[model samples]
Target: MSSINTNKKNTITWLLLLLFTVISVYIGEVLELFTTQKSLFIGAVLFIVFLKGQQIIDVFMELKYAPKLWRRLLLGYVILLPIIIGIIYLV
Candidate 1:
C-alpha cells in the first residue's frame, strides 16, 4: 500500500513538473509576443523555476523525509535565487 502511494505520488509529481515545464515554455515563447511587461513574465518564469527546483529537491532527490538540516541546506540554494533576482531587478 505504501509503495502504491509512493508510486502515485511520484507520477503526480512528474506530471506536475511536466505541466510547469510546458507553462514555462509557453511563457518564454508564446507569451512574449503578447505582453509588453518584460519584468512580469520574467518574474513568472522565475516563480515557476523556483517551483521546479523545490519539486526536484523534495521528490527527485528523495529529501521529503530527510532531516531538516539537510533539506534546508539544499532548499536554501533554491530559495536564494529568487531573492538574488529580486535584488538585481530592484537595483
Candidate 2:
C-alpha cells in the first residue's frame, strides 16, 4: 500500500516537472516576441534553469533526505553556476 502511494507521489512530481519545462519554453518564446534585451531573456531562462535544477536535485537525485551540507553544496552549485553565467553574459 505504501509502495503504491510512493509511486503515485513520484508520478505527480514527474508530471509537475514536465509542466514546468513546458512553461519555461513558452515563457522563452513569449519573451522573444516582446523583448530585444538579450540579458533579460538570458536571466529569465537561467532562473527557469535554476528551478529545474533544484527540482531534479531534490526529487530525482534524492537529495531531499541528504545531509544538510551536501544538499546545500549541490543546490548552491546548481544555482550559482547559472547566476555566474548570466552575469558573464550581461557584462
Candidate 3:
C-alpha cells in the first residue's frame, strides 16, 4: 500500500517538474518576455526553479524526515540558489 502511494506521488512530482520546464521554455521563447520584461522573466523562472528544487528535495531525496540541521542546510541551499541567480542576472 505504502509503496503504491509513494510511486504515485513520485509520478506526480515528475510530471510537475516536466510541466515547469515546459513553462520555462514557453516563457523564454514563445512569450519572448526577455525583450521587454527581463526582470519579470527572471523572477518567474527563479520562482519555478525554487519550487522545483523544493519538490526534488522533499519528495525524491526524502529529506523531510531527516535531521533538522541537514534538512535546513539543503533547504537553505535551494533558497540561496535563486538569490545567486538573480544577482547574476543583475550583473
Candidate 4:
C-alpha cells in the first residue's frame, strides 16, 4: 500500500511538472510577441524557470526528505543562480 501511494505521488508530480513545462513553452511564444520592453517577459520566464527547478529539486531529487542543510544548499542554488543571471542580463 505504501508503494502504491508512492507511485501515485510520483505520477502526480510528473503530471504537474508536465503542465508547468507546457505553460513555460506557451509563455515563451507569448514573449516573442513583445517587440519592445522584453525585461518583463524575461523576468516571467525566469520565474517559471525557478518554479520548475524548485519542483525538480523537491520531487525528483527527493530533497523534501533530505537533511535540512542539504535541502537548503540545493534549493538555494536553484534560486540564486537565476537571480544572478537576471541581474547580469539587466546590467
TM-score of each: 0.83, 0.84, 0.89, 0.87
Which one wins on TM-score?
3
lDDT of 3 by residue, 20-47 (tens): 9999988878446347767778888888
Q: Write the per-residue lDDT of candidate 4 for residues 19-81, one digit (tens) a residue.
A: 888987887787768656667767887888888888888877988888999989988998899
Local distance difference test scores for all models: 0.88, 0.86, 0.88, 0.84
RMSD vs true structure, all candidates: 2.1, 1.8, 1.7, 1.6
Give the C-alpha miss distance for residue 2 in model 4, angstroms: 1.2
Off by over 4 Å in 2: none
Off by over 4 Å in 4: none
Clash tally for model 1: 0
Residue 11 in candidate 4, Cα distance off native in Å? 1.2
How much is 7 displaced in model 3, in angstroms?
A: 0.5
What lDDT does candidate 1 reach at residue 12? 98
- Per TM-score, what order, best first? 3, 4, 2, 1
Instruction: Name the runs in model 3 displaced over 4 angstroms.
Output: 33-35
